[model samples]
Target: MTSHAATPTDAEAIPNLNTRNVALDRVRTFLTLVVLLHHAVIPYTYFGQTDAKSWIGFDAIILATDSFFMAMFFFLSGLFVWPSLADKEAEKFLRDRLLRLALPFALAALTVIPIAYFAIALRRSPGTTFAVFWWKTITVGPWPSGPVWFAWVLLAFDLTASVLYRVSPNLVDPINRLSLRGCGRPTDFFIFLLVMTAMLYIPMRIYFGPGRWFEFGPFSVQASRVLLYPAYFMIGVGVGAANLHRGLLSMDGRLAKNSWVWAVAALAPYCLLWALIFVKRGMLENPVWLPAWYEASYGFFFSAFSAATLFAILGYFLRFKRSGRSMLDRMQAEAYGMFLVHYPIVLWLQYWLFDFEMPAIAKATVVFVLTVVSSWAVTGILRKIPGAARVL
Candidate 1:
């Protein structure tokens, strides 16, 4: 969700490129809503349910969202990176990224994350004071970054892209060429993405397992998909390197026309993933350490599903939402800020509803609606502070 705003100089350097892509803006805002929905329903899923009521439907929803949303976030974040780098001095680019990404990540890790996680701590020990819990979290151990981990990781990727840009501006030229070809044949790009992600994700998943995360203080990342994310980011950089309008995301492109095909492609691998999950749970007895073969198979389907879903979602937006001001357009300016602040609202709502007797679906619906409205309102208010709009 990096800003797509371009300077006058950028318009000169990249001719025919619009300052903003309404479709992609809508896509990013939609993803923010997806993130909200993911968190809201997770507590009702069979795997993560902490409530008295659990629903299998929520398990399906979690499965789909968990598979691709964050990786797609990285891809969307990367789409504007190369252009930004090319348009500004290296120092200026890095400075802007630090202010936009790193600063928000730091503030959220220190304040937002602790407040959100305090709900969990309170569940464990009702008498735990916020000050004591916050101190223990920061000083002692296990300071979870929660969802804001994306911000810091994106900062790292942006910094890396800057260094790579300095080394060779043409480093991603091959990807740019591929993107041009993908204008008419998006399957090629999808195939390349699937292969790249599989190579990066499958082996690491086998080695580290799906649940293993590399954590240090408030900085944590899923070990299995660390390389996978950067791969997507770099691909995004390549696509936006040059001739962005005439490439894979072109409004007149086949990618938009064949959106349904990509949707089918996404569905196939997603179902395969569920089959593997069933085999692991029912046949393999859900072992603590899944076999390498299971992990490999699962990893392949996961990668395929993720890549195909990225295309499906992007294609749908490009095809049907290329113009006009929708609700997503209205939310675009506030999406990133909402993402940063929603965790606390979601966690607190879940905690408060823990004692309620409502059905799982009803409770999840309430949480999702309230989190969206509350987070959007909070972000709007925060943006009103002087100099806050620059960061938020």
Candidate 2:
């Protein structure tokens, strides 16, 4: 839908776009914690149960987090790209992206990922040495990137956006206009996002079957979500193109006021996803190849739940915690570093805890808390090193 340019009143109604958005920083910090929690509880979950103890609650948590967090991270990462591009030369932006994303991704793939997955290898073959395992992982096969995949993928998106900007700076003006309309009617933006993601996601999920990944050494991504992630990223680029505060994300906007509505919207599709899970397990008997209809249904519900959850989380922060000086604010600086470094801490903690006879909840709680504290502490220490802040 077409809309007029942002008026002075619209700009005056919210915080300056040029300034920091405390709420989004907090949201990013919260997502970092979610990443930690997702990994922390994976060992205890029913589906991914690597430990003797398993919990249904963890399965639920995994289902919800897996459906949306990474995509939302891409969206959030894209949010400031337009402004950043405007402020810097294309070459400078690429260089900064390489330093911030590619370098860390390379380092983590070489060191952090190997170390993290070594715990699993150790569990499988107690006699295996880290040196041997690392060699095989690097030279022979199956070099999983772990969470650091986000860094490189975001860098790719950044590169693509830079080229697109060079082609035409107003490439995303339509979405920006849509975002402006979303200030009062967020449902419009939500629907647009839902439809776009579903269009991009469903057919790919049916064709690729969700379990397939495209991998090359440390670079790998889920096949079904490859297009989906870029869509979210571009939408974020659009929203941040201009008049960010005067658009959908305005603190004084209706999206913030109607946070509970999005919560409700998220719940319905989430429940539908669970229902589809039951259908897959019970009726379909977890077939090697799911029916096309089942995959389509699952994909739609997945996309819907993801879109709704994004709004729910963003709205909650924009409405209630926009100005807070909480733990999130304190951890904001270290959060990205924590995300980069937490995987090894989590896996190693889980590995050590594996032999301990504890309930799943207790083990998960211990793993999550220790991982947070350890990662935060480690990131803080690393940031003190000369020149590390630029990369971390």
| TM-score versus the correct structure, for each prediction | 0.95, 0.95
Give the range of the ten consecutive residues with the poorest summed lDDT in model 2. 1-10
The global C-alpha lDDT for each of the candidates, from Candidate 1 onward, is 0.84, 0.85
Q: What is the lDDT of candidate 1?
A: 0.84
**Residue-by-residue lDDT tens digits, candidate 1, 1-392:** 10111100011123235556678878888988988888888888777848888899988988898888877888777777787787889888877877887898899889998998899899989999999999999999788888888777887888999999999999999999999999999989998999999999999999999988898997888999889989988998899888777999988899989999989988988898899989988999989999999999999999999999999999999999988769988887788888889888988999999999999999999999999999999999999999888887
For all predictions, the C-alpha RMSD in Å is 4.1, 6.4
Highest-lDDT candidate = 2
TM-score result, candidate 1: 0.95
After superposing candidate 1 on the true structure, give the runs of residues whose Cα lies further than 4 Å from its correct spot.
Answer: 1-17
